[model samples]
Target: MTLRIHFTGEDLARTHIAPQPDVLWETMLSLYRLRRREQTLVFGEWKKTALGRVPGSVRMLTTLVPVRGYTVDFLTPRAEPGSVAGGMEALRRTTGERLRGDMAELLARHPGKRLPGWAERLAAGCPDALDALVGAVDGYFHACLSPYWPHVRAQVDRERARRARLLSAGGWEAVFSTLHPSARWSFPVLELSYPADHDIHLGGRGLLLQPSFFCRQTPITLRDPHLPPILVYPIEHDLDWARGQAPDRRTTLTGLLGATRTRVLETLAEGDCTTTELARRLGVPPSTASRQATTLREAGLVNSHRLGQAVLHTITDLGVAVLGGRWSGLIA
Candidate 1:
């Protein structure tokens, strides 16, 4: 299928909601500020004072990072295919029965129209074990972010009302009439979501509101910044690129693994280094360093070019993108 990608400038200009590029950048920065704060609370304070107080903060941090990384990885466009396929695969592997049940339910009576090709494939692939099949699908989605339909719907409703107020507030036309043209084109805000009954038509541009994070509810930093230098997108894009591969490479697990592997690749960007060198610098074990390197090589993060008796690793183009945050969801 041909996919229409709306780049930064053209999209915003067509919408006519022109705000200074600096203002837009600041808005993204604010979101990042919020995300950092949230991460601090979840990974730092809450874990230390609450959950970690009982279970152990280090373990909590370790577990949460992978989960957060998984969700972050799943949200980006590049990694989306993996999100779909890996989700299906994981459902098959983990909750085959539940997957089957959900699929049967979808086939019998879903809230929306007939299941899409991908969704149907997920259900029909494993015949008798409907529940398992369905569960995997359900779990894959739930694992990313709980479908906050209620939350998203509420936020969208509020935004719609607020927008109406803005339009009717009289300054609306004036704001657009003498607006800075660059402001409109330079910063595009694309909404990604799982397919829904309602679609948002911004000016004439159709936003791909895929099922992912509900921008309204997510802490602002999670929002996609129209431009880079202020926001990164590569990691997520890499994951998307990876997902577009054969089904074997899909999954949040792969995304998580890929992202972690990406980081290891970056460390090697300066030059090839031994696993021991990486472990010491990265503060991990020799085993972890070695395993991460192996994974990265497999995922095409880094390459092992033999140097004498020892093998040295260096980042590839993929590794550069990941380290630089060209793919938003992958590493960050």
Candidate 2:
């Protein structure tokens, strides 16, 4: 079956890339991924590490987000630009009407389906139930994704850089065509491989393109078409990240590149960044970041490209060799 998303010219014009990964969306989607043993190369180690670490609170919460089909939207707020704390705050403020409506719709999808006691209570919009939901989400995120967050953010950033290149080359249509093997860009509609066939009309609301590290296989969207439109797709992974955090090689890098320069390289290695982004990350002045990026680019440790008004800087393959991961383990 195909999920057809119809877009208007206004929709296309207003469509925007999410500036950062949506924390709650990833958290909610991961519940499905954690239940099954799939994609061993990408998720095996992470699942193994998280299998035992999942807290009881989250385990109870998982009943609402089953292994497949129809998860409640109230559990995951809008993929706004902010921190996890911000997302949790949004969940905490979910109105009683919305809580009742979302859960009723979810249960309606599988008539006569019985949820756990707490989950049923959640459907009733009990205040305590919302509290429990927030707690469980916090526990799940901390246990499963917190440690690997930097790596997760890095993967999302890598996708952003790649999409930026595609946009620079061929515009929005190119982005939709190559978004994933399952997706096809055909004129006014974006078709996706999905379990169910349905139509989501943009109605000029536009769409938010959100890249997720934990999203696997197929892309997903909110079941309620009345809400703001969002497309959450899995991003390409770096197999090296599955090995867990390596021993710090900062000492070695500092010896070769000095403290600030070494930090610059490390930051770029994590994700491609504009000079302003690099500066913001490093807490340094823009001019200082630019100069350092120039030095690194001149030394062939980084590549700088003019994408629009910003110079996007990415670590070169040689720089990858120096930091070490995909090419080989830490530099000797």
Candidate 3:
């Protein structure tokens, strides 16, 4: 089975690469990976730790995300590029009409497949059902994803940087040509090997390319094409990424700039990011991160710019030089 995506010249020009992973999508797919025994080799430690700690409230999520086939579209809304809380809020506010329609389609497609009571209540727009579902998603993230998110995020940032370099050096054709082995770019069409045979005519809506640490083997797309077209493909990882943690290699830099400031600089070096994202990555208070970033900007080691609601920070050439040859060799 193959998914043939028809692209226009406008589509090519409009295509976007997400700066970070979608929290809801990543949590939903990670659950799918957890349920499968075949993923043991890839997520061994995570599975071992997460299985025993699965909260009773979130256990019902197992019913919603099956090991195979479709999951409800409302669970992973792509309204905007925002935090996990924003995504969950969107899920909670899924219109009754939309929820029921999606559920009806799911039932019709699967014939006699059994759905949990929560699914029925959710379809009917019960408030408690929505709360319970949101709780489950939150609890699941706390149990399985939060502990290792920094490491996962770092790997994702690395992949994004690599792709950005590709885009700069060789244009869209080069980027698409090496996107993934399963994805083939041949002129006006981009072909993806998938579990179902389908075609999407991106009538100038363009496509969003997202890299994921959990997505493996095949790229995934939303069932409905009318929604913004997004392709979530796996990012390559090494043994360190698989270990679910990043080593503390900033000791030398920490000596130069206090620990917190060094961390701020290191995080900025990964890629351009918002103050909020920097704080989250460093596990520091947002105000503290902002202060540190301001200090760096004043010293001419970082540059800050505003894009909509976000204040993005990027390392300056002097900042890279300050990181010196040793740190450069380590990340390289």
Candidate 4:
């Protein structure tokens, strides 16, 4: 049986909460750096494991150059060599390279979903400036992945339909926002279908936004060799107290460890506390604390860096607003 689903572009646009272009740009760049850095840490940790070091040939092939063309490095050895171990290593390398490449391409092109008019205006102001900005923006796009993931899937499908059309499409950030009102970059609100039977996510009716990005075939098993299997974060009443320290609509934070993480943020709003201290207060292990902290830090919900030997976590202005639901106004 076939059933027709209807949803307008206006619907999808509304789900997005609009932040100023400059603010969005900065957030993207920061996210890019964090993702890159986090991946590197993960790679290093993996390398120390028995299965960590993939063969040198596989390693070379898997190494991807940022912003380079679509060619992945390590396909040859895996295809030709008759070594299963080598191929497995090659596949691991390939996974990282492919994920990074896709993410880079996504970032470089995604913002157009919200800022095509701004791009056009910039191009009109000074042609050379547009060229320079594209290069600068390309580097910055990586961080904004979480914010613009919805556009990444749609844009990719459009490109696959034809080759020349894809190359000449400028970038995702240049065209995705085409449906928006040119006068203001605000997006139309959108709805998402959370299907019970299958993994189909229909946003704005049939509009599919990055299905693969959300597809997780494997179980989430925490197996950190360096730390315990689980760590806990403290819970509090007001996470917003920390967020109140930042500007409105300046940052966006979204992640998976919601229940425990949200509670920790709410508790912190009362005042600052260390991970161990917070864990004691919340009744969770130290490992859970570490992972959630890392996730929160990457999402821009919390700020953390080395303070001597200890890492201090604090909610930023964006975090405060998110906990308080102050960002509802920015959504279409």
Candidate 5:
């Protein structure tokens, strides 16, 4: 089945990519990965580590976020972007009517399922019940999500950078077309492969493209069409992302590209930047930064595009490979 998202010109114009991963969204989606045993190649190591010390929140979250179904939107209230504390505060502030409605809708989807007493109290807007829920989720996040968040944030940030490059080179159309293999851009409608068939018409509310580390397979959005639309999709992962430590072989890269060029590549890996910004960071003349960036571009290790007065440079896949010490000696 496909999830068809209809977009008007205003909607397209207003569409934007999130700067970072949403802590609440990723935390919620990770539960799906945890409950399911699939994707062992991608999530296996992290799962082993996370499950080693099971917090009570694990059991509670698993119940609410069923392995394959809808979860209450209140649990993932639109917080201050990527802040966990902000998300918890937003969650706590959820009105009783909204919580009850969201929880009821979630249970309706599951049919026979029933909330526990605490969950029931949560639906009734009981302060203590909400506090317990928040504490449990916070504990789970500290134990599981916090440990590997740097990796998660890096992956999401890289994906956001890639999308920005694509947007710079092409437009919203290009972004939608290349969003993922599972998605298709047909004029104003973006079609996504989803578990069920549905349509979300964005009546000028726009959409937020959220890159997630734990979200896998297909993209997902809120069940309620009235809510602010957000499409949470999994970004491509580094095989070593979930592994404990990232490889550090800057000395080897320095030997190959020299110290200045090596530093340029490393900086670009962090994000796309202009030659001026690069020069500022490198504390060199604009001409020098331009020359080094040109060399990296010539070697097929970087991608640069012009934007008004500044030239934007991004690290290509090969650049990343070379910088990360996973590159072969040959450039071509």
Candidate 6:
């Protein structure tokens, strides 16, 4: 089965990449992966840990996300650059009407199925059901992903930067060609090998290319074609990438850079932030924060961009590498 996306001139013009991972989407996909036990090499440990941490009540939430089948669309909100908490907040706010409609659609797609009790409650717009579902998701994330989020974000950022560079050098052609092995670009049509066969005509709505850390092999698209078009593809990573070892050399880096600068780098790895925000987060003087950022920027470990009156500092690829204790160059 293949998904062929027909693109127009406007579609080509509007097609763009997302700057960060969609937390809700990732969480939903991770649950699917854990249920399917797919990519055991990468997710085995995480799956074990997540399942162990999942409460008895929350275990029912897994039934909603089958190994292969329709999962509700509202489970994942639109992609935005930020923490998973923001995504959870969106999930919590899903309107009862929309939830019921999506749940109805899910059940309708799979005929002769008995709806899980929790799902039934959720579809009925029960507040308790919503809270329970959200709690389960949060518990799963804390158990499985929070510990490794820094490493995950680093890899995602590096991939985004690489693709951005590709876009700059050769436009969309280079990007599409290098996107993934499963995605084939032929003229105005982009063919994606999917579980279901369908054609999505991007009637000038374009598409959003989102790289996912948990998505493996096959890329996923939004089931509702009428909604915004999005393609969630797996980001490439080595075996050790999932293992997430920062090396023993971090102690040396900490000693050299002092605790405050090291904390700044660690915090920046989560996401970009202004110097003032960084200072407030770390409880340091704004001048001290500025000096540290300047030092890190001069070292080529961090990059700062002026966004209006505030300058946002983000960890560069080298910076991520250094945080992993892989960089052996001079600390000064």
* Best-fitting candidate, scored by lDDT: 5
190-219 per-residue lDDT for model 4 (tens digits): 212221111222344323221111111211
Clashing pairs in 2: none
lDDT of 2 by residue, 67-186 (tens): 777888877778356388988998899988888888888788877878788877877788898898898898889988888887777668667777776576557876787677888888
- Candidate 3 colliding pairs: none
Provide C-alpha RMSD values for all models, in order: 21.3, 8.7, 11.9, 22.2, 6.8, 11.2
lDDT pick, better of 1 and 4: 1
TM-score of each: 0.22, 0.75, 0.73, 0.23, 0.77, 0.71
**How does each model score on lDDT?**
0.36, 0.79, 0.76, 0.34, 0.81, 0.76
lDDT of 6 by residue, 21-113 (tens): 777777778877777846886677777766766656546556677667888887876634646878788889889987888888877988887
Q: 1 or 2, which is superior by lDDT? A: 2
Better of 2 and 5 by TM-score: 5
Best by TM-score: 5
- Ranked candidates, highest TM-score first: 5, 2, 3, 6, 4, 1
Q: Distance (Å) between predicted and true CA of 199, model 1?
A: 25
Give the per-residue lDDT digits (tens) of candidate 3, residues 1-332: 99888899999888988887778888988987788876665688778788887899865676667678877777788745537778788888888887787788778777787878888998798889889989999888988898878767766776677678657655776567667777787879888889899788899989988888889888888888887788888875543444533344444767768878887887877776788989899998889989999999998777775544667676754565567554433443
Least well predicted 10-residue stretch by lDDT in candidate 2: 323-332
Error of 4 at 245 (Å): 12
The residue-by-residue lDDT of candidate 1 on 246-296, one tens digit each, is 122223433665555645765675545777788887888988898888878
**Which prediction has more favorable TM-score, 1 or 6?**
6
Q: Deviation in angstroms for 126 in model 2?
A: 1.7
